[model samples]
Each structure stands twice: as structure tokens, then as C-alpha cells.
Target chain A: MICEEMQERISELMDAELDDNESIPVHRHLSECQTCRSFFTSCQKMREAVQSIPYEDKRADYYETKKEWWRNYVRVPLPAAAVFILLFITGLIGTSMYLLQSDDPYVSGEHRIIYISEYPEIEIHLLTDRE
Target chain B: MDPSIIQKLRNGNEEARTEFYKQYRQQIYVYCYQLLGNRSDAEDTAQETFIKIFNGINSLQTAAAFRSWVYKIARNESFQLIRKKRPVALSHKLEYLEKDSVENLIESEDNARIVRNAIDTLKPEFREVILLREYHHLSYKEIADVMKTTTSAVKTKIFRARKSLLKKLSPYFGGI
Candidate 1:
């Protein structure tokens, strides 16, 4: 194979991604071509040199700080949200009960007349049995 | 991807979350470091990666895909920071190094820095492929998953990336 084709296959050769039949020509080219061989060798050395850099593994502090942040963010609003929901449900229930037991025309209950209007001749009634 | 840890994390277990962070933070940091070529940027990216992972872990369909998923997040986060900086020097340096002998370079701390500089000069696409394949030792299929591309595409990209790296480093290697 030509150097260009072998060059294209170099990474696969290094990574062993190429099957044996596919790699044979590339390997043969590398053995014969000094330039391609040097290129491949440099690539390997570069990978090693890059990988050898010692990265600091001290991330415990960052993890702790982030964990605390997430906790505070989530913890503070949860109980407040629960209380708000509870209050809303209680208010809903109270309003429903009041409406159900009231002597308004829509409530369907025994009533005593509380007020009578003159012009429109409308009567307002209150539920005496509700108490 | 421990199933029990995943279950606990899904169940909103704090300790499990912490354990998960401890388990994967180093690898993620190394991935970020290799991609970004800077310690501070890697740390920030890693932090953001974990936060995204924790917040979105519930949406992950299976525990087995955790590594690739987390890597995807790290790649995205690193790219975001890189875009913000918009370092013009990297591309210019790559252009300049195209005329130099990178292969003849020696392996010293200084040469390591040069190698890192060479890597940093790569476009994000090529740089990520090189880092994932060379430094992280991710499989082609795993890299495809992280990159959301096909395994063939990953292989091709890695090949091209290594070729580009070889060209960039060849000048330093002297007459080769």
C-alpha cells in the first residue's frame, strides 16, 4: 500500500482497531517506509507523554462544597412547599364546607330570611340549622 | 454503574450521590483535563459535569450507560467554556507548528507542556476524539456513544486526529 493509505490506517493500527487482514498492508508499509514508521512512533510517544502528566486527585473539598450547596438548595424550600400545600388544601376544604352548609340558593339547605331588598325585591336567607 | 448506587441516587439518597461523585470524579477530571488542557478549566468543567449528572440522572434510562452519559456532559461543558474563552492563540500556534519538527521533541516536563500545547491547539472535534481514545482509553463504540456518532465515524475521526497530531508533532521530532 502507498504511504498515504497506510498513514490513514495508522491510528487503527495503533489502536488495534484493524483486523489482521486489513492491517497487514499498513504494517508492511510502516516497516518499509521510514517516514511513516517515525510518524507512528512519534504518535505513540506523544500519547505516552501526554498521558504521563500527573493530575491532582484532590477533589474531596470540591465535592463536599457542591454537595452542601445542593443540600441547602433543596432542603430549605421543601418544608416550606409542604406547608404551603397543606395550607392551600386546608383553605380549600374550609371554603368548600362553608359553601356546602350555607343557606344560599345554590347550597340546598333550610333557610331563614335575613334581608329583603325593595327595588329588585330580592330576599337573602341564612341557614339557621347550619350552626 | 452499580445498580444499588443508581437506585439510591434515583431515590434521592444524598450519601449515594456523594459516593457516585467520589467514584467517577477522577476519571471525569482526567477526561476534562485532557480535553481542555488546563487544570482550572478541567476542575470547573468537572464540577459542572457532576451537577448536570446529578440533576439529570433520573432521566438516564439505564445504569449501564452512566459512563458514556457523564462523558457526554463533560465534553459539552468543556466546549462551552472553550467557546467563552475563544482562545485565538491555539489556532495560530497550530499553524506555526505545522512548519516545525514535533517528532524529534524530547520527553521532559517542558516537552510534555509542548505536547499539551499541541493538543490544545486542535479543534474541539479532533481534540475530543484524541483525548477520549488516547488518554481515556474509551472503546470506539463507547466514544461513538459519547459523541452521538457511529463507531465507524469515531474510528475515522480518531485516525484523522492522530494523523493531525503526528503532523503537528513531527517538526519537534527533528528530520523525521
Candidate 2:
């Protein structure tokens, strides 16, 4: 196969994804071609380098950290929700008390004399019990 | 993943949740670290992934599929962070390697840095496939499930991703 075609197959070949039928020709080509062989070899090396990189293992505290995370997950919203509910109740109570205590005619239980007509000869008064 | 642990997790057992976190944390963190290319980001992403997994555990239909399911969460979380950060550039020098250079590169710390940079240079899709397939040793089908793609598509992506990395690292590998 030409280099372009081999380029596509090279990865599959390295991954061992190719079946014997497909891999045999590619292996033959690599043996005969220096460029393809070099590229394939480099790809393998890169894979190995990636796989061998050293990384710190911080998983020792993962369980403890996860516990804290869960705690915060539950703790944060609960208090906030409670505060919100408490504020809502307080606001409702405050508004109800204000409405009950206010002297406004609409809400207050009081008697008032409303004048219907004020004329020189006639006068009429209506008593309203706003309770 | 044990079925009883999953059952306990579903039943809101905190100890089971902790055990689940302990079981998968390292692998998940390593997966994230490989994908994100930084310790801090990997840690944050892994933490978020676990939170998501626990929060959504009740939605899981089967315990046998927990590995795939958890990996799917990790991949999503890592992708989200990658999108948010969007590293500016991923560049590395390409130079020819001497004979027996692959062993030398594996032994040297600098080679590790080079590999990490090369991986970061890849597009997120390619990076995900490579990390899942190579570093995590996940099967093509498992990667497909995590990526929500076809197994054939995953294989194709892995091939393409390897090709891309090979091109980028040609300098280090003797200009191949």
C-alpha cells in the first residue's frame, strides 16, 4: 500500500484492531518501507510514553473529601431553604398583623358617619360599621 | 461495581456512597487529569463528577453498567470544564529521536511533559478518545458508550487521533 493509505491503517495496526487478513499486508509493507516503519514505531513510542507518565495519587483522601462534599451539598441548600421559608412566614405574619391593626377604613372595625348630601335646606347622614 | 453497593447507594446509604467514591475516585481522577492536563482542573472535575454520579445514582437502571455510566459522567464533566477554560494553545517541539530513544523518553520526566502537551493540542473529541482508549484502557465499545457514539465511530476517531498525535510528535520520534 502507498504511504497515504498506510498512514490511516498504521494506527489500527498499532492498536491491533486489524485482523490477520488485514494486518498481514500492512506488516509486510512496514517491513519493506522505511518511512512507514519509522512512523509506526514513533506512534508506538508515543503511546507508551503517554501510558507511563507519572501522576500523583491523591485518592487517599477521596472518601473523606467526598463525605464533606456530600455534607455541603445537603447542608448548604437546607439552611438556605429554611431561611427562605422562615422569611416567607415572617413576612406573611407581619403583613396580616399590619392589616388587622391598621386604622384604615377598609380594614379597621370602626363606625363612621358619612354625609350623603350637604345642602342649605336638607342634610342626610349614613352610619357605616366597617368591621 | 457490586450490586449490593449500588442497591445501598440507591437507598440513600451514605456509607455506600463513600465506598463508591473510594472505589472509582483514583481511576476517575486519572482519567480527568489525562483529559484536562492539569491537577487542579482534574481534581475539581473529578469532584464534580462524583457529586453528579451520587446525585443521579437513583436514575441508573442497572448496576452492571455502573462503570460505563460513571465514566460517561466524568467525560461530560471534563468536557464542560474544557469548554469553559479553552486553553489558548497546545504546542510541542518535534525532533528526531536517537536509537533506543523510546525507552529514554519513557524514562525521562521531560518526555512526559511533551506527551502531555501533545495531548492537550488535540481537539476535545480526539483527546477524549485517545485518553479513554490508551490511558484508561477502555474498550472501543466502552468509549463509544461514554462518548455516545457508535463503536465504529470510536474506532475511527481513535485512529484519526493517533494519526494526529503521530504527526505532532514526529520531531521527537525521529521525524516520522
Candidate 3:
């Protein structure tokens, strides 16, 4: 194969994506061609250099930055927050209205439980009416 | 990833998620840095990527490749940010970052500087394939999954990226 065709196989060989049988031809081509051999070497060197770019791990920085990002960007959206607030307000108003409407709250002399507007009956013989 | 950690993450355990953040933060940040070519943007994108990862942990299946899943979320988040910020302001940011990068290249050796320059000259798509294949050492299948492209496309991109780099470095290694 010409150098152009072998270059493709050389890439596969470099990546180890080729089987032994497939790589043999590319290897033979490299052995026979100086230009192709140099090309392969250059590719390998470039790959190594790119990978060798050091990755510094500042754990504290990463932690702080991640927390900051979450605080700044990952919070609830404005629309969602608005929806949540609306739901909360609706619930508050509902409970307030129910409590306000609690006129006959079954004020019993025996039971010590508080039921607001529920069980709307003045227990029997309780309060004595004082009328 | 251990099955227990995956389980914990799926259960929304913050510590387990933090563990994953510690493990992949550098890699994800480097990827975003190289792709976006800005430290500030890369940091923001990487952190948001983790948030998306934790938020979508349930999408990870037991049989799936965990790293691929992580990269897919990261890639999507990065692209979303890019789309959101696709204004003239972005080009200005990139130009400034390029200047910063150029200053650092002077401190590196000639060969390293040449390689960096060659890599930077590549289109972002090709550069990503090279970084994924060489730096990250991801399999073509995994890269395809992360990129949402076919393995054939990944292979083609890697080849073209190598070719581009070789042409750019021909001054030093001129046999090609």
C-alpha cells in the first residue's frame, strides 16, 4: 500500500484498534518506508506530549468552586421558586381560613385534644350552659 | 465505579456524589479548559456538569459504562452553555485566553510548544477526539457514547486530527 493508505492503518495500529493480522501490513509498511516511520513517530510523540500536560489537583479549590457554582447556578429557577412560593402561600391562606372558620370546636371538659373546626359538637353535659 | 457508590449516588447521597466530584473534577475541568480555552469558563462548566450528573444520576443504568455517562452529561452541559453564550462576547473571551495560553507556551520547551500550537490549531471537534483518545484513554465506543456519534465517526475524527497535527509539526518532523 502507498503511504497515504498506510497512514490510516498506522493510526489504528497506534490506537491498538487493529488485530495482529491487520497491524502486520502497517508494520511492514513502516519498516520499509522512512517517511511513514517518521510520521508514525511524530504522531506518537504528539500524543504523549498532549497527554503529559500536567493536571494539578487543588482539592480545596475544586471543593470551594463547586460549592460556589452550586450556590450560584444550581439553585431553583425563578419560575420554580415562584411556583413554590405560590403553593406555600396558598397553603398558609387555606390553614388560616380554616382556623378562622373554626367557630364550634367541640370544647369538651374530658378530652384534652385540640381539634379546630373538626368534630363540631359541644360534648354532652360540658360547660353546663350556665343559662 | 463501585456498585455501592453507584447505588449511593442513585439514592441521592451527597457524600457519594462528592466522592465522584473529587474523582473526575480534574479531568472534566481539563476537558472544559481545553475545549473552551478559558479557566473561568472551564471551572463554571465543570461544576455545573457535576450538578447535572448528580441531578440525573437516576439515568445511569447498572449495565451502562459510568464514565461514558459522566462525559455525556458533561458534554451536554458544555454545549448547552456554549449555546446559551453564543454571543460576540465569547469570541472576546477566547481571544484573551489565547493570549494567556501563548504566554505560557514560551515557558515550555520548543517541542512541547509546537505540539501545543498544533493541537490548538485543530477544530474543537477534532481536538476533543484526540483528547478523549489520548489523554482520557477512552475506548472508541465510550467516546462515541460520550459524543453521541458513531464509532466510525470517532475513528475518522481521530485520524484526521492526527493528520492535521502532523502537518502542523512538519517543520520539526519533516519526513511526513
Candidate 4:
């Protein structure tokens, strides 16, 4: 095997991302293993090379312009939200007014509520007719 | 991040928000620049990332998660731009070109440039996980959170990224 598991552990250990307890096995393995030792060395070199690329902060003014986009100039979602709330409130009022004033049988409650007992059983009425 | 800063952020304090921005701007810019391989795309992506993070600040649950959260936003934003502008990103690759040997140029500034080119050739998934670990100094667990994957997955991706970089660089200078 390539001491692969320990090599992975060594990567974390090199970065000090592992606590001492978790690092114990890695240390023990590195002490006894050469493959992982070389892996660790290469990882360090790689880190150095990658970190050497200095950060470039280009167009600070342009970046400033891009900032606070949500707070100031959200042209679409804000208007969409306002439209949503307005539609919701309008729908609520329309439904309420329809319930109160319209002549729709369901919404206006103008239809009479007939209890089941108010209707004579069709079977009984049919028997009476036959008799 | 300090808990007090998080609290200030929650309270929508402008100074705290600026503090948060200052803390991350360099890291975010560098990460975006390296990933997108261009200043314009990098700047646009970084700005969109900050906008997303600040706009979604309320959803962050803890102070400790802030670093990974910022990275997650940056990673997503960078990849989104890459997906939209694949040709632009693809043309930017300068990996493994015939150049001065890094071993000879070890003490020179060009070594960093060579290493950077090497990293650029990596496939984005491998490139990202390795950058998060090596360049960003994020822990395996933190990277897992940012990548939305298990730590084992992160370890595997990083290991593969290193091998991939080595394969590219070895052609020129016998590998790191």
C-alpha cells in the first residue's frame, strides 16, 4: 500500500487542522513511514507555491459600485415583492367584499341551508305513492 | 469571526458589515481571480458572492460557520460564472507550457507564476477542493462544509488535485 491513509492524515496535520489527539496516529505513522514523509514534504512545497500568488485587489471603485446592490438598486425583486403584497391585499379585500355583498350562492351565503331532516326520504315517499 | 460582529451583522450595522467585507475582500478576490483566471470575471464573481453572503446573512446560523459560508458563496458564484462563460475560462489555461524550470527559478518570482499555471489546468472540482485546502488554508471539515460534502470526500479530492498538479508540473521540472 502507499501509506495512503496516513498520507491524507499528514495533509491535515501539516495544516494543523487536526487536534493533538487526532494527530497522534499521524505522527506515529510519519515516524515509521517514508512514503508519507515524502508526501508531507511535497504538500508543504505545494502550499508554498500556491500561497505565493499575491492577492490582487483590482478596481476597488468598481467593487464599491457593485456593493450594496440588494439595499439600493434591486430593481426586479423589490417591485415583484411590492406587486405580490398589493395583489395579496387586493385579493383579500376582494374576497371579503364578495362574501359580504355579492349574490353568488356560495360566497354570499344567499342559498338556503336545508338540513337532511327537511327532505322526506325518497323511499318512504315512493312507498306512500304506491300505497 | 467574533460573536459581537455576528450580532452587529444581525442587527444590520453598516460598520460591522464593512468589517466583514474588509476581513474577506483579499481572500475572496484572490480566490476568485485564481479560479476564474481573469480580473474582470474574478471581480464580478467576487462582488456577486459578497452580495449573496450579505443578502443572505440572516440565514447563517453561527459565528464559527462564517469562514466556510463565505467560501461556499464564493465557490458557488465562481462556478456559476464559469458555467456561463466556459469558453473564456477554458482559453485562460496556461498550464505545463515550455518555460523556465521552477527548480532553477526557485528563488525568483516566476516560481509562483509557474505554480499558478499548474493549478489552473486542474479540473474545477479537483481544483476547487485543493485550492480550498492548500491556498485558502481551510480545514478538511471546513472544506467539507463549503463543498457540501463529507471530509473523506474532501481528502480524496485534494489528494487527487495534488496528483493532477504534479502530473502537469512533472513534465516541465520533474514535479514538486
- Write down the lDDT that model 1 would get: 0.75
Provide DockQ values for all models, in the order shown: 0.29, 0.33, 0.25, 0.23
Ranking by lDDT: 2, 1, 3, 4
In Å, residue B7's CA in model 1 sits off its true spot by 3.2
Best of the candidates, DockQ = 2
Candidate 4 matches the true fold with a TM-score of 0.69
Kindly list the per-residue Cα lDDT of model 2 for residues B31-140, writing each as its tens digit: 88777667778888888888887778878987777888999999889888877766431321122223223444554558777776667667778988988878887777
True contacts kept of each: 0.35, 0.50, 0.39, 0.40
Clashing pairs in 2: B94-B171, B95-B171, B95-B172, B96-B174, B97-B174
lDDT of 2: 0.75
Candidate 3 residue pairs that clash: none
**C-alpha lDDT of residue B103 in model 2:** 40
Cα RMSDs, all models: 6.0, 8.0, 9.4, 9.2
Tens-place lDDT digits, model 4, residues B1-176: 89898887766666777778778887898888877777878877877887787667778988899899889889889889889988755654533233443444455656667777667557878878877877788988899998899988887788778778766666443543
User: In model 4, which regions exceed 4 Å deviation?
Assistant: A58-131, B91-109, B170-176
lDDT of 1 by residue, B82-116 (tens): 78876753664456556432443445447766777
Highest-TM-score candidate = 3
Output the better candidate (3/4) by DockQ.
Answer: 3
lDDT of 3 by residue, B1-176 (tens): 78788887776666776677768878888777766666777777887888787667777775358988887777887788778778854786567557745445545566665566667767888888998899888888899999989988998899998888777666655646
* Candidate 1: segments with Cα more than 4 A from true spot: A19-36, A55-70, A73-95, A102-131, B33-41, B81-109, B172-176
